[model samples]
Target chain A: MSVGASINARGLTKSYGSGEGAFHALGPIDLDIKPGEFVSLIGPSGCGKSTTMLLVSGLEPPSAGSIAIDGRPLTKPITEIGIVFQDHLLLEFRTAMKNVLLQQEIRGLDRAESRQRAEHLFARLGLVGAEDRYPWQLSGGMRQRVSIARALVHDPSMLLMDEPFGALDAISRTQIRHDLEMLWLETRKTVLFITHSIDEAIGLSDRVFVMSRSPGRIVDEIKIDLPRPRPAHLGEYPDFAAYTKRIYSVFEKLGVYKFD
Target chain B: MSDQIAPVTSPPTPAARLIRAGWLWSILNSVLSVVIFLALWEGLIRLFDVPVWLVPKPSDFLGRFLVDYPEILRNALATSVTLAAGFGLGVVIAVPLALLMVSIGALERGLYPVIVFLNIMPKTVIGPILIIWFGVSPLVSVLVVFLMCFFPVLVDSMHGFRAVDPRLDYITRSMGATPWQAFRYVRLPASMSHIFAGMRIGIVKAVEGVIIAEFIGSSAGLGFMIMRASSFMNMELLFCGLVAVAIVALIFNALLATSERIMMPWVRPR
Candidate 1:
């Protein structure tokens, strides 16, 4: 099965509040994501990367403009989109396997098949022995992995991850990043990953979309032409530093960083 | 490699052992205290040659209870039935009211202050009024119990529902869970401890409510037996009636604790 979905946004805009109090969070922006592509959205805080993901996932409607997924207008419920957040957000009362099965429950999938799928996903995520453990019993990294397993349990074509590893320690963050990259490579799902770390975006993304603050819009798009099966040691490469330097320059030009 | 993995065996701490022994020690202490008090009373009665009608010795009370055990048991059953009916009714009424309070902000704002005022009012004063309206029937007694028990359950459930983590709601919504699903999976399960806490208090109040209603009007329950014994200065029978009430309350509370344990095995009692 082809695990990809084309996403289109034309003049997408989102605002909070009304009239005098209205604050624009995003465009009037246009973008396109080809199927099976890994895209990372990088920007300063309040640049609306998170808001853009929310709009694209059909959790919230765009204030203006249009969004389409797989050539269908994204007006109704978009069941094919998977979303993960900064917080693990696992239900503390449920076991890891049960939490993963929640996607099947919400999507109205058959019980026996969903449970089998959940077990397979848990095994693939290296949580085979810990399926019955509750969220509170697991470490932070383990809990976040459970969240990922839950997001992918239904085999969603598009995965929207907003700072999914932000709460992990440095070591766990690196490990999860490697795991995520391998998962992406194997599944070839269209991924929209949002993060603040330029290194993470450069390390994982096929393309990076950088945004400007205060009425957010995509200000720069950088293609990472690094080889497939990128090594963890690629961060040490001169080319990786060059890409980081270019993205940092965009941030500098946007006045997102102040030296004085 | 052997040093890398330590064996995970440790003896129970002194604190854990103490906690394990705590309940037995408390029960023994309580028994000792009651025994000493009863011995003192018996000695006083024997030495002073007081009339049995004035103040019954422990033996006298126990003897009367044993002789009329069947009658006492029957009356106790009547009281227990009334308590169950009233408490069940109160819980049924309060839970929906609490859910309504969570769903409708305007309704909550309008009703909460009035509920607080009603809760603080002297509920005992309404006992006579209920008797007059429903005429010493089981319905009147049950209604009284319901009135006494309803407010605490309502207030606690409302607080519990309101206390559901907003982040969890966001998670549920993002997962495409409907409003009912959010309530069933997130809000209701999250509020389990609070609801049970309310029920624990409400059960006690329900027992008290039934006794008070019976004391005011009815002639069948332990409350009625106590009233009659007090009027005739039969202190032994009165003490027996009081003991029956205490035992009923104890049993009800124990059942509530057991049910809570079953429902929320994950929650540890502090």
Candidate 2:
């Protein structure tokens, strides 16, 4: 069993260029995630949700603040992490199996163990026969599933998913949401999922952080107290509707939804 | 349910069969068209009683091909060897140089403009200049072919390497991939389809370059044979030389297409 790492950030900010021309992308924000917790950042475009994920992954340096993973100040891209992007970001050349194995190949992990784990993940993700297919051969939904398997193959301590199901069809979105929740129930990896879907943010996450537009800051944090295995029709759950309404009101206040 | 199963169990439909046999069918179609064209040419030439010096009949070149088989074979072989050498060298040099240039911003900024300037100038003009520099040797022919191919391969390869989505780099870096590992696993494979596209253009240019070089400097090769045949008014031999060059170019293209399929199987129609 793999224990998840807690994520900590203080005054995390990112700005591109300099002086009068500088574009402030994110932050002067603070975030703390407990071990094995599921959290989501929901906001409009340009809210720096993706930027926040990038900084936490340490793929890019923050202009002004600091991040600590498992209480260690991060100076480099952390290895014990999996990242999924909206584009699926799969290498078109490799088969689905090889793409999943790439994590093991890069990390120099035990080959047989990684292969076994990858096979298990494939089975769990409903990707049994898709291991040999290239990204182009698979449907949009199957491709996303393969990407998810790749993210989890190495059993990372933290999973950072940025709109993993945004491009998927409605059915795939629902199915993958359920599958992701079930997987989280099993591994309990610390997850920081970013999305524009309010229902998704509330349904999958233990806590949802609503962010403001442009120089984004976490405007509100809503903890969902709903029962586990959240119902497919989230509208049936009174608390789910309350959570949705609360996030909507934050967006409305931020001028995302305007009424004359 | 029975209707759905019936379709699966039945023989393949005509459209499916045609698509499955598409490659062979296309080749046969091309062969048929060429044969018809040759028959028309042979008939017209015989009807007009035209002199062979003016334009040899298809049969006339066919006869020439049979009688001068050894000579044509030798010259064709020479041309093939020179083309292979020059094109191979160009690929070897250009791909790595493109990689280096793409990796280092300063090198790309410094060198790309000069490369573009060179590419814009006519490579044909440089054939005679190369002969003058290298003194009418096989080396001059090789150098000309190299010059012809180098630019396109380099430019397209640079484009391929730089065309990678920035998110891909982040994906690899998040996994703690070293720069070399990221390049080897991701950048190189991602660039292959583009690299092969460059090679396709390079091979065509190479065929043209070899003939130009042989036209100016070499005493051997199909180009030299064509020149010799023309001077003696042996139209049949000139036509034979031309046919040989066409076959060689086709072969190079076929080889490249096969390699592309092997290297980047994802690009093949599923």
Candidate 3:
């Protein structure tokens, strides 16, 4: 928590449509993520978790307030960050390796250098021999791994993951969570991960921001005390009871204790 | 044709099974079907003692087809040339127009109704209008085929271009990809399958368009040959000409199928 703020946002707010149909999509809340920190945003379906990620990534502008990344204002579209979306969104015609190289093409970086980096990343990410395979040929987990490789291929400082494992089966999700922990431990990049599951948020992050729905805003910020090399099964860990209990307590404050 | 495509990573089990049935089986199947159909027709015609001016006996049709084979080949060549020209031009022009229509709202608004209205009008009506403007020539035949081929390709390409997942564009743009880069890398490649769908239907329309043109106006193609046969009540020759037309269409379809396979190796041929 002592590290300098990697991403600083003050009074950040996003809304859609004019009066009557006007909808508050996101916050007017202050946020500060420390350097090399992993933070998860947990909220209901309409809680604007994705909108916050988009606003920070410069994909959308906040109606009021600003976001600054590493002390640099994100007033325009920038490539200093990478995002692994909920959907892998891999081009079907392309091979896994070529899809990773897509980051290079977008960044206007050297192809040979990016290919070498992609090879290393793919291998490190457990995609060694599957580089030649198309997205359809690979399993859902593999596609998500390829997407992770793509996000890192450009060597961006920050990674914004919008529930990248949300679509995967339980086994794949648990498996990838371990792999992601390994990835983060090695790279130590600033990350903002968004998910609906309280277990996922507490299982992965150093900090968890519980959000409320409708007029979405951060309602609680819990510094996760779960130890590193996180427990594979949240149910198996003794500390999970305390973390889950606390996250549910936040939800209960809104009169909603659903665990979906 | 599918074999010429790169070995797809996902094995297409059903398509592979169909292919394993082999060329010999396919040929025999078609030959058997054709024989049964011709035999039934021949039996009915002979039993009825139908006039030669009506449906001629298959044997008599074959004999006359052999005699007129040289003329049939020449007419086939003329029609094929015009059809190919029109179809090729239609592909080159319509696809770009389709892209323009999808990319620009103003163009879509101004030209869409005109395009739809033109497509709705009977192609036969367009043939005479083309003749009136350009005179009785091969150009009219080519123009008619082009017109027929145009709408399908335009519609299909537009569909393909818009068919790109909006998320793909969002991801590309969020990654700082310029509009042109997004179009080149994501939009265009994603649209290939749809564009090819258009080409498949467009090629068939091209065949019909060229024939209709020749039938109505031109005097140097298979359609003209049909006219000549009908005028003389040469039922065998007319049937032979019709057979030639069908063969030509089969060739076009085969050619298009191969091109589709070559261009879009990811798409399993159905």
TM-score of each: 0.87, 0.94, 0.89
* Candidate 2 residue spans exceeding 4 A from truth: B1-30
Clashes of 1: 1
Per-residue lDDT, model 2, residue B128, is 75
Residue pairs in candidate 2 whose N, alpha carbon or C atoms collide under 3 angstroms: none
**Model 1 regions lying over 4 Å from their true place:** B1-57, B173-176, B268-270
Clashing pairs in 1: A13-A27
Cα lDDT tens digits, model 3, B1-270, are 001113355545534534544343455676788799889989999899988776778888878767878999999999999999999999999988998999999999999999999889877787878878988899999999998989999999999998888878667876789888998888888999889889999998899888889988897889989988888887889999888898788778767765665555665334
Q: What does DockQ give for each predicted structure?
A: 0.22, 0.49, 0.37
Report the C-alpha displacement of residue B267, candidate 1, in angstroms.
2.7
Interface RMSD of each: 5.9, 6.9, 8.7
Compose the digit string of candidate 2's lDDT tens values, residues B67-160.
9999999999999999999999999999999999999999999998999899999888987778778887878888889989999899899999
Superposing every Cα of model 1 onto the true structure, what RMSD results? Answer: 4.5
**Candidate achieving higher TM-score, 1 or 2:** 2
Per-candidate Cα lDDT values, in order, are: 0.82, 0.88, 0.83
Least accurate 10 contiguous residues by lDDT in model 1 chain B: B1-10
Highest-DockQ candidate: 2
